[model samples]
Target: MEGRQLQQVLNPQRLKALQEWMQKSSITLTQVNGQRKYGGPPPGWQGPVPGPGCEVFISQIPRDVYEDRLIPLFQSVGIIYEFRLMMNFSGQNRGFAYAKYGDPVTASTAVMTLHHYRLPDGGCLTVRKSTEKRQLRLGDLPTNINQVKLLTLLRMVSDGVEDVMLKMAGPKGREVVALVNYSSHYAASMAKKVLMQAFKKHCGISITVKWTSFSKSKHVSETEQEDGTSTPPGLNPFPKPSISPPHLHPQPFLHNVPAHPPLQSSFSAVGGPAGPPRDEMKPQGPVNCDTVSLLQWMCEVHRLGTPQYEIRYHHASSDGFLCFSYEVLIPCFLIPLYGVIQILPGPSAQATKEEVYRAVAELVIQTICKVSSLRPF
Candidate 1:
């Protein structure tokens, strides 16, 4: 079947599979006169032809200039397909504009020569390929899309992905840029349609997918690099929260508990007890249970240093003379301790290890007095 006939017969699934190999590529047909005597206005040196009917973006124009200014400047050389001054939400000119010339010859000449010219109001004009290639193409896609990924997605949407390329700006890792390339205009149009409705969230930033004509130098191949490296952690989505040393019962063990009770995962389960053996000090029962292992895993995944943790048990009947000591509490117990300390009285929270310990001990001592023998652990 020819292109259009094949398109009709294939079901969506079959159409999807063929799309990869049959990716979109722009076909530039140079219009000709039948008798061969057709000529060129070919006066000065104009660069490569943009291939008939391509569009170019013209920007940095004086807002006051209207259609009267645009028609003549562009029509003087080649056919003026259309001209538009990009506007803002209020319909005011954005200072930049876009224009489509009839064919490659006109578009290229405008980009190379007219680019540096000054508009009537002395505004410098720069002509580039527009991001709105969707006007002349196909596919549905979001605007803030990752260029490389967009091509891959376009293949899934339609058989029109013309080409895929990434552009990098700035220095190496800090480069700020967007990916761009072409697709059969149809493919480009479809991508724009799909992405606007469905693309994954990236750092809470929305995806944007559009058309581009940057098939040259600024165009990047996957292998090319201007010094790229891994992005630093924490700045990205869902970084593991770091449980700093301040959160832990600094001294994992004290006179309160005898054994550090190696939890079996973290090597930081260092320095045994301060007093006597765990059993001798307090009629020790099973110090660790199956749950400790699970807790250890959570700590590792959450980056909570388990071995440096503690759990302190105290005598319930100490009156106001209650004294408590650091006994290396696991992150499970310590995290809540942080909350408890939040509403704690003033002078007690001195931001020092001694102050925190003192405050926690004081709160526990007072809160526990109201409790009976079965103290809430």
Candidate 2:
């Protein structure tokens, strides 16, 4: 059983026949070679100790709505043993989480009756039976966000974030790029949910949202695929959110923040060639010596004019992170680092820096989207 190949292991069979045979036959069917047993321990044998309770998962709820708004809604369906909103690595909501009831019957009742119940905000809530653990993101933040901002914001959300990185990128003068990394992928997903709600506080700037990890690589939509990292986010493996008891804590206010890097980088080079200088870089989770660094093969950025800049993240390293980038050459342009977006008035007239920036920010915001807020999706 340990080293046997598929050809030598359990014989592939019609699932229906196997199910019928298993139910009728007192003799257990080990496999192609009959080396294992597929039955309970013994007649009067008791099962091993039970661990955590099964989870009842819920997803797609908008974050601005709070725990108070939710508890009663669920209670209307069944007596919940416990309830909680899961936080992510960046302190955002993962748009999904879990709940638990005192018994399986109660959990089942909720699944059947309240799985798709409507929220006060008028969004469909998706619920399901689950057994996995729910990772917490900690708290909330503004929705007009990027990865870096989320990581920073979530440290305030909970105590578990050991490390995280959020990045944002896109063409200069266009929407700049941003993504947030969490010490745990679970934490990152939760942060995204909470951040979208909290960040939407600004007048008309709702941060665009998407997810990438070792698993599903594509953004939540075609729009979020600006910096495509293939079909998967690298190596993410997903375990759905499960049910559990709830835990609450008084959240913090926005006014308080750690001494931040005066994020003065200009809008012209948003999510540009070189990511923020590797200041206090946090190494990813521990790996064996064989685990290599996922750094760039080659990269360089060249500004041609106001509408364009050349960038290259060549996947030069044969077996390394297949990194690559593109160059912009539209109204040729060059934007200085740490400045506002400067849409040069003409081909090469010294851009009235302030005026140019204001114009560009307005245009990019308009083109990408006019989203004032984001509810759960």
Candidate 3:
């Protein structure tokens, strides 16, 4: 009967409902005086109590595992108050879960019995009493997102974003998602709105979000008679009439980029410096390995790293480094037959006009002349 009651609480529909409620209500994992205005701890709960055996954190949940596997494993020793596996926006496990027992003694017993127990998937569990219960995972972000860009977007939503994680995702295991941990639940709740706006503005797509926090115990007096089946105590398991933040509209991120207009060539169209038409140009000339050798020598002399040279019927491109001592990056493009190579300065590079443009036309022309004389077939 005890095991049967535990299974009822772990039902998929019930868990889904709890997750939805938690997301809609902006439930959090931390205990704070300011959270009362948002919503107090979940239904049938007293408040935060700091002591041993109240709760245990399981840090290594295998991917194949679920509530069914977890509920029975923990309930073997004692009656549990609540159990929750932290989930991301995509409804995938975030590699951790939490369980609180009816009493501190039961919690300790479970910890001792199952701390290092290995799961079927070969993952050993890390269960121990939780002390610092303040963590939340942000999910449903676009794939291949730049971290710096994501951070800038998050800051637009809240000033309390303390950490960020980009983890693997997708059915094919090829996509990436973002996870943000805020200093407080309030900041995290507010983050949801701003992140949504940021996603739409930057990615041009709507995103889903889910909130996951550690479970806490309901007040002992409020849950004395029942079999142990109840919604796990989270930030607020039961919704209450609470004041909402008046404004959740997110402002633009600090590094937000404005739309760019179509690119126009600096060289004009008719009779421009872009040179002769493709049909009018001479046939493919003899290949110039000397120029390639010279380019390689130049790269080596300056310790600019290895350079790649490409040659095609129409033109060629080669990549070469400018500096080797530090991390300064300058992009230098070589245009075939055009005689000039354009070197663009990096963002933080303090290069002067002279440093940006170096005359290598003479060498290029010489190499082309020497190579062109060899053949034209």
Candidate 4:
């Protein structure tokens, strides 16, 4: 039976046989940093680097399943540009992998044909389009930092830093932010884990590292139109500037919200009227409030000065979600509020910032609403 054969193939004693099977099949896998990769574009023919939507995310793989089975199955759809299987120290797969093809059409075909396909062990595979994120947003940097210097410093600390773009941050443009593109998502992820500590130790400057949003509005719009679903409004209030300066772009300005806005109106929209009485009211769901508006309302009600955001760390998971460890400083409280949040990957820098802000606002509102003492009006 297929199941019995699979069990035999995966037995510890059969690893040599598996390797020999791979060799006989002309499949070469190289291990690197907890992943086993086949073909940096595949050994055979020449073509351009795979673009967006050319990769399919595969999950629900049986730990015993290796490329010897997966690669050939995928190749039945089309030529595989590359394949990577996440690995563990115990010599088994991490239950997920990515398969890239020569084009988006082929990737789509692989997803259509292989998704939910049953394995010999009765496990089904989950396959879908990959976002292919390869950029990191570095925030709270010095305004004087230049692209060349940043690229140099990043290279000293991380690998696959292909390009760096500088942007002005803060209302008066007093701070700088950098958008760093890596050769691959894996490289960017590894760099993100180390860049925060590396910068603090080497340059004595603390920085916020997060995945940069790559906009997918065009594709989303097309899909929505086909489904006859209405498009959502843009979360960011400010319009993007018409032009970017050389390698520098403008950062999201959080100070644009009026400082003296009536707090009652804001709370009314989120829950009921703002004040001590409203403290008991639970937010219906995610507060439909933007970060700037929420911060303004918080400062006005609590008498706390402008809050500070310090992203301690952030990383994108294989499932296309970004997780962040962040701190928010309230003037009235000596210690900053620490928490973690997960959000879907966004399409642009501004969109991503808005998502973080909205998430933080929801957290703040939920927290204060639960603890009346924290309101201290």
Considering every candidate listed, which one attains the maximal TM-score? 4
User: What is the alpha-carbon RMSD of candidate 3 to the true structure?
Assistant: 25.5
Expressed as tens digits, the lDDT of each residue in 52-100 for candidate 3 is 2246667667644556557668869765556656555434455666676
lDDT of prediction 2: 0.34
Q: What is the lDDT of residue 76 in candidate 4?
A: 96
Per-residue lDDT, model 4, residue 261, is 18
Q: Is candidate 2 or candidate 3 better by lDDT?
A: 3
Against the reference, the lDDT scores of all candidates come to 0.35, 0.34, 0.42, 0.60
Please report how far candidate 4 places residue 207 from its true position, in Å.
3.1
lDDT minimum window of 10 residues, candidate 3: 324-333
Candidate ranking under lDDT, highest first, comes to 4, 3, 1, 2
Instruction: Name model 1 segments beyond 4 Å from true.
Output: 1-53, 128-194, 199-377
**Residue-wise C-alpha lDDT for candidate 2, range 1-377, written one tens digit per residue:** 54355323322333344455556644343321111212222233343411122235676666434344455566677555445455443323445545654443345456657667887557887665442212222222243545555556557753335433222223322234332334422344455556556555532345555553212232343312321212111122222222111111011221122222122222232222122232222223333211011111001111111222111112223432222221121111111111123221233212222233333332322221222121111
TM-score of each: 0.28, 0.24, 0.26, 0.52
**True lDDT of residue 95, candidate 3:** 65
Candidate 4, residue 322: how far the Cα is off, in Å: 34
Cα deviation at 142, candidate 1, in Å, is 17
Q: Backbone clashes in each candidate structure, one number apiece?
A: 40, 60, 1, 3
Ranking by TM-score: 4, 1, 3, 2
Give the per-residue lDDT digits (tens) of candidate 4, residues 1-377: 97777556466654776687787988788998778999867776586776444677777788778887788888899988888888888777877888877765466567667878998766898776664556678999886777787899999999987667676655666667777767666677679789999999989988999865422234443322221111111112111112222223322222221222111111111222322354453433327644446655666655554454433213566866565544454433322444666566466644654565556555555554443334422
